[model samples]
Target chain A: MTAQPTQTGKIIISVDAMGGDSGPGVVVAGIAKSAKKNPEVGFLLHGPKDVLSKLVSKRRVLDGRVVFRDCPDVVTMQDKPSQVVRSGKNTSMWSALESVRQGEAHGAVSCGNTGALMALSMMRLRKLPGVNRPAIAILWPSRNPQGFNVMLDVGADVRADAKDLLQFALMGASYARNGMELTRPRIGLLNVGTEEHKGRAELKEAHALITDFADQANFDFVGFVEGSDIPGDKADVIVTDGFTGNVAIKTGEGTASLIGDLLREAFKYSPLSRLASVLAITSLQRLKKRIDPRRVNGGVFLGLNGTVIKSHGGADATGVSAAIKLAFTLAKSGFAEKLAARVASTAELEQDAAQSALQTK
Target chain B: MTAQPTQTGKIIISVDAMGGDSGPGVVVAGIAKSAKKNPEVGFLLHGPKDVLSKLVSKRRVLDGRVVFRDCPDVVTMQDKPSQVVRSGKNTSMWSALESVRQGEAHGAVSCGNTGALMALSMMRLRKLPGVNRPAIAILWPSRNPQGFNVMLDVGADVRADAKDLLQFALMGASYARNGMELTRPRIGLLNVGTEEHKGRAELKEAHALITDFADQANFDFVGFVEGSDIPGDKADVIVTDGFTGNVAIKTGEGTASLIGDLLREAFKYSPLSRLASVLAITSLQRLKKRIDPRRVNGGVFLGLNGTVIKSHGGADATGVSAAIKLAFTLAKSGFAEKLAARVASTAELEQDAAQSALQTK
Candidate 1:
């Protein structure tokens, strides 16, 4: 592994090697692989130094791109978010996130428990100015050629009100613009229906708020959407409460896999089906690669002061490596800063609107 | 189609033929196939009389097992639940559900808009005693050889409190016991972690409430269970709020499909993988058939007065027919009455416990 220089000095991705289901072994391996591919990049692998060193010795590696930050403890999935952040001072996830916050690294990526990661990042780097609550922005494959669909507030706020939802929409819009390079991203609130009266009372209220903003702003707010509309390119950015958002993403992933399994089983039952599968195998593979959730390993936790990437807890080397690369891209794009600026101005605008309404009354 | 006699009186499954993505054509074909296997059953095919009659004419006879009820309008997937229920007076889905509610039919099934069905059911039949909200319960294949995993609150009660969750757990347990014939079914509350304090504050509180009731004479209440544990046979019944439950189920479905597709592609890419796929194909199909969501399409909306099953909105004929079968089973088994009695007693017991605790304090 060799260090590769980015135009902006150096692109360093701090890896929480001790995080995720497989621990530092896969994370370390992924970083090793990623480092070898990108010569100008460097990694600050935060974990137990001795263990990582032992693991690294078993594999082939040059040196400069790899380094270790000693973190004595690791955050378990079962631990409370506060406990993991406050009590586990020497945890790998915490240290890696801290490295990015303190500007020692350009960005950080963790395939750990999402709850703990969100809490620790908030407590360390903190939320950006005018951001009520940071959101977990995930890129899901839409039925369009434009890469993927970005949804936010996946596991950030459980009991979200109208205001929280509005903030989520704004944050997601900024991420789409800055990270995915989409201008005036069409934002849709994932509800039971597209009508104003379709969703819960909170959603209706949120719709009223965001619609007002969209009337004035550059962003395209496309009313409301349902669970089925997620796969379609109805909107580039989808926003919802963490609970619904999390379930929607998971459901889509689960259903897609289930259907694929069904198709495979059907194909195997007869010679004719098998012949058809053989013919369509290339196109099928391409579609699978495109829709694979593992390919989009890291989800940006939007509205934070610094870059906080949440990788899949069950990620393998390939997935974790993709997350590292994603974090590098997000950091370079300055998505966090863009979000902070937008949110700050939006909050001011909302306040002015409220004031005017009150004075007129 | 012919109606035959059973010990529990002649039960009819009224299916809305003009529902789902593929329409009544697939539904009629599926029902025809199912009816051939079970001649003792009866069906009331509700939709546009002309369209349904034309489709039915193409299918083989089931010895008078099939009938028809006319409905004028069809509800689209995008229609709001409330609006559809209110205005769709003569819709295929509405008429079928009404037949069940009015006791003209024992059960009804539709591959219609889910929100519309839920709204219509709640509006007509109303909630059961001691149950604030109704839950849609689906059976997923478990590692246990006995039956499938009973998951409740898939899309009912989005803003559920701890009390609401407790009600759902009890309802799910009762349904599992009566419908699935699992006595003393172990109930697990779905959370992010297995630990008591892992999830949101509400979940933590709900865990305490459930644990407190575990030692009582009701169903065996297990502690917290994670998303991954649901697939395993850790608990017979799993309960969560509608938002999380729906997502988890969807995620499970999608992820499963994704894995199968990946395997299919891999097998096609090489000779060795193809051989392995060939060897395991039969066993895999059997397993998949057992776990298919479409096969378990009829999810009972427990905590509602009378029997109302929510078939998946995107359900095909097989799924709709299965839902119809599920509804009949519930009706004949007298599950609604038994659950109502049990829940009434449980409510009384809870009130008594609260009174005693206050005296002690």
Candidate 2:
């Protein structure tokens, strides 16, 4: 494959070509698809040069936009997050993130072990100033007019104190604004019940803190929201600790897929139903497209010095392309820089809220 | 309404008729539906005698099997759990639970405030011996041959320690056995990841304790399961703290409904799609029935001294009847007594595991 000259004004995404369940070939193919649609997008692909070259050579769309780096090592799924951080210097994941840190790429995309990728990204790009814990934000298809809602802290860690939650609210607001193009996104704290007196102690404290910052942050604080409201129009951004958010998103995915599978089974039950299925195939396809998880396949790592999008480890070519598109959008919109400024501006207000909570206790 | 003598061998359920979102009419209609199908089922309906008599008189199937207690007070949804425990003696919710405690009914069903109902039940019936916390378990529709999987503590409380999780697992296993009739139910600890090393410290401890007790408890322990597995066939029962379980189940419900709404919108998008929808109406109805929330509407409060099923507050006749049927099945199967015995037998083992966890800490 011929190496292209670096385009001065293009949005360069550093792609980690190793560690995906479907292998680097799928990643390369996905980037080629994105490059064809997005003429302004370029790639600094990191993997074994020989392997990546062979794959990229097969895709004509990638000829003028791809640059390959020979990083022979790979991060295995079994590798612990701590082990990867300490010993994965030569791996493709490390190289991809390093390119972002060094300003060679605007952002990075990885379809690898989530824990390992998160660890490497944090170590390489560092957290934005005044942010306590970074969060993973994903767009959930919802009943809203926009057809998507943002939910954050989907598993960067298992815990979040009141301060971390306040930061999540701000970071999430910034993400919704940039990604969803909302001027004032509605933010809700995820709890067991929507009532004010429900949920854990930290969540209650976090609710108060977020309420205090809502006006200054320029987002509509919708108070406490139950899990059902996460996919409803009640809130554009739902904030929770990583543990709850992680479980909720996965459960939602699982339930939707189960229903889809059962619907197919119902259509195949008899000759009459099968005839109906054939006649209804086009309408079903439209419905399928509306709810397809692959259409929104990236989880953006928020509150970092630079943005990094984590594609599903087992994502196919279309899913990978979706992640690339997300990275390109965030980079072009300067989401990482805007989010940093949002969190930094609220640092004093968060400290005041914490002090008040401590005084009351 | 004509009064009748209490039957000698019928299974009577105490129904709290005052506080449902749809009022006593729906509850009375529901019990009448259940009574029509099962001659052995009866109801000790708790509400104002004059009001219930008018509703029962409208349902011909309820004529001979209904009995009413004149509890004029009602438990409002806004009543605090603590407040209800103190001053709810005259309320219909309290009367319904008291009947179960007094052995006048085999089990109880309530559609009032969850917090109020749970508080009254715990105070009245008390926790089973050696049970630290009682859980509310619900059957989630799934791909299992039995068509459902048991998940608990869907919200009796927001917290559960390692010992509490162990209790939930044992209780959930018993529920699966009695409710779904799995001889040796597969029990899984719900966590962020399926890997043993990938969650909170309490979850790790709970995993170890549940693993150790699996053999003696006569349930198969599937080490750790993620939210995706909640609706899958990998486990017959999924256990978690009430906070996580509550959020997960609600999130799953919300996602399913969102998809359902979107599917309808897709089918109505154009004349061609609308025509296709008409042809596929039968297949669509079959699919809808399979995933209807009303078909499995009850949340059974497990590990309590007596059984109590909490129906959805806004449940229609069909949903209320589903809850009644669940209560009836648990009563006939002797679920509460069996669960109490299981917990009593496991007391020594849980104590040992707690001690081990403490020593390790």
Candidate 3:
């Protein structure tokens, strides 16, 4: 491998410059934004050297701060996870993840196919010990004082059983601590109701299991929380099966976008309304900043040996930069190591709880 | 039995006036608004005679348009469904459903505990001939020209198999035709992904089954849709199990409420924004009216012997009125009989499809 540009002692982020809806240029711009804001961060940009070089050379802030890797293949959104795992070695997404696997970068950031990224991530970085299923955790804007709550298993897999949910609680709590800097984050299992008897059969089982681990895990178990409580400050870490979590997140996002569109149309209905919009533009912008999905752009892959942050496929420069910032923070804090340690003890907790239950019986 | 004041040949509606969070006062006010706007509709108000009479007497429009049923008990929100089923015969919710069961009222409307109401509905009204599980269908604001789309199984039974989902599609299509007045409504099965192999095993089976029944059922099968399409224009009717549907709806509502609250806070942050708010009051009101959850407040119980509308428990008089309007429309259209006819033939269709599959095999 050729020696590339680097800043001594600066944290390096592996960036997949291809496969985003906005193309490689936007990815380059996003890394440049991060590079300008944080002088202590550099990038391992993976994509076509000819295209990436042109884009990187144009950004003055990125001078001597980026290492370019020539990865000619790109993973499309439509590619199946299984297909990508078998034949995607040359893709930018795979190459980017390779840097993290080889310890050449602190973490990897990609705006590629989510399923494929997760699949490649699992193959390249490997699952941490004691994790049956690795999960993707994202920050959801909430009524909490910290302004965001962590939700997990958003789209890692469609199904999660009772034991899986217990592990999610462990991982989510870890994320809330290291990622959000919360000392003792409260975990809530997502269900149809807060009542113990409500929801699927597995939820009742998961409830008991999560409650058993909370004390030892150093996080408070808030018990069951309904979907309405997701953004209502009931819990700092909302946990659920990926199918339900994915649906809930997308539904929330779709509703917000619809309202935003309607709000703009409402303001444009008349000349007087248009004038009001102009006057209130700053306030509207403030509101936009408060609830913007773009600000919380990264989905951190938990229960993995190396950190991987998945940015939204359609994320623009601002959104991508927000994701990079999140990746840098997690990498700097050694979030992957902490999360691995937390997950590694899950089996011990379960075995102890089981033994105590036998004694009580 | 007390004699009711009524206009000759007016449609009668069964209404639980006690179980709502707002009390009988709001229920009486709601029916009164309905009476004033719709002269051809009357109500059987179920509650304590003395208490309901006092509330109804204050509304001038309801002077001669309501029948009072002296049901003395009230079902609070905390009541268990099974407990209510065994011991709730005297409660207003049960009494209201009894009216629909005995054909005294065309349909039943309630703003009470959803589970209790659904249980009482099934026990009192019973399921249609071929439905394994009943569903609650609600109108969601969407980009369609009709301004809303229909979604089902919001909070009925949490579990729905492939056959149950097929029944939901038939019932949802019937609702769109009757409720939304769409001739041939398009139906989409909700999943985490639009891909055929992405969701649960049952979803794949339901997808094929829905596609098979679409043409004969008089609706277009739009195949699979993601949660984001719940508010999109991809389909007129979105179908899912009660657990997923309930989460999606509540998550959407919770997110919208949070955004609305944040928008208000943003406007209040500055004196300039305060001035802009005053100028944009009309535009803001216009926007509020367009997406007001209160305006679309009813969740219709499908595949039942009689129509039942479950309004939001926290709804005010306006939301109650919206539900009553829905009950009135469905009652006027003789929706129960049409839906019965549609569902009555589902078993036959399934049997025929089975025969065809056997022949092909």
Docking class of 1: incorrect
- lDDT at position A111, candidate 2: 94
lDDT of 3: 0.89
Residue lDDT tens for model 3, A3-93:
1225578888999999999999999989988988998899999999999999999999999999899988999998999999999989999
TM-score for chain B in model 2: 0.96
Worst 10 residues of 2 chain B by lDDT: B1-10
Worst 10 residues of 2 chain A by lDDT: A1-10
Q: Estimate, for each residue in B1-361, the C-alpha lDDT of model 3 and write its tens digit.
A: 2213244788889999987888888888888888889988999999999998988888888888888889889999999999999999899999999888887888889999999999989988889999899999999999888999999999898899988898999999999999889999999999988888798988877887777778888899999998888889999999999999999999999999999999898778788888888888898998899889999999999988999999999989899999999998998887998899888876799657534534553
Per-model B-chain TM-score: 0.91, 0.96, 0.96
Per-residue accuracy of model 1 over B131-246 as CA lDDT, tens digit each: 78888898876565564788888777566777778788888888988888887889998764566655677777667666666556367877887665566668999888886776
lDDT of each: 0.74, 0.89, 0.89
Candidate 2, residue B298: how far the Cα is off, in Å? 0.6
Considering only chain B, report the TM-score of model 3. 0.96
Q: List model 2 lDDT by residue over A227-285, tens digit each.
A: 89988999999999999999999999999999999888978877777776777678789
Q: How much does each candidate deviate from the true structure in C-alpha RMSD?
A: 5.3, 2.8, 2.5
Better of 2 and 3 by DockQ: 3
lDDT of 1 by residue, A261-348 (tens): 5567766767755765665566556767877777888888887777878889989988988888788777678665666777787788
Cα misplacement distance, residue B192 of candidate 1 (Å): 3.1
Using Cα atoms, each model's DockQ against the true complex is 0.19, 0.74, 0.83
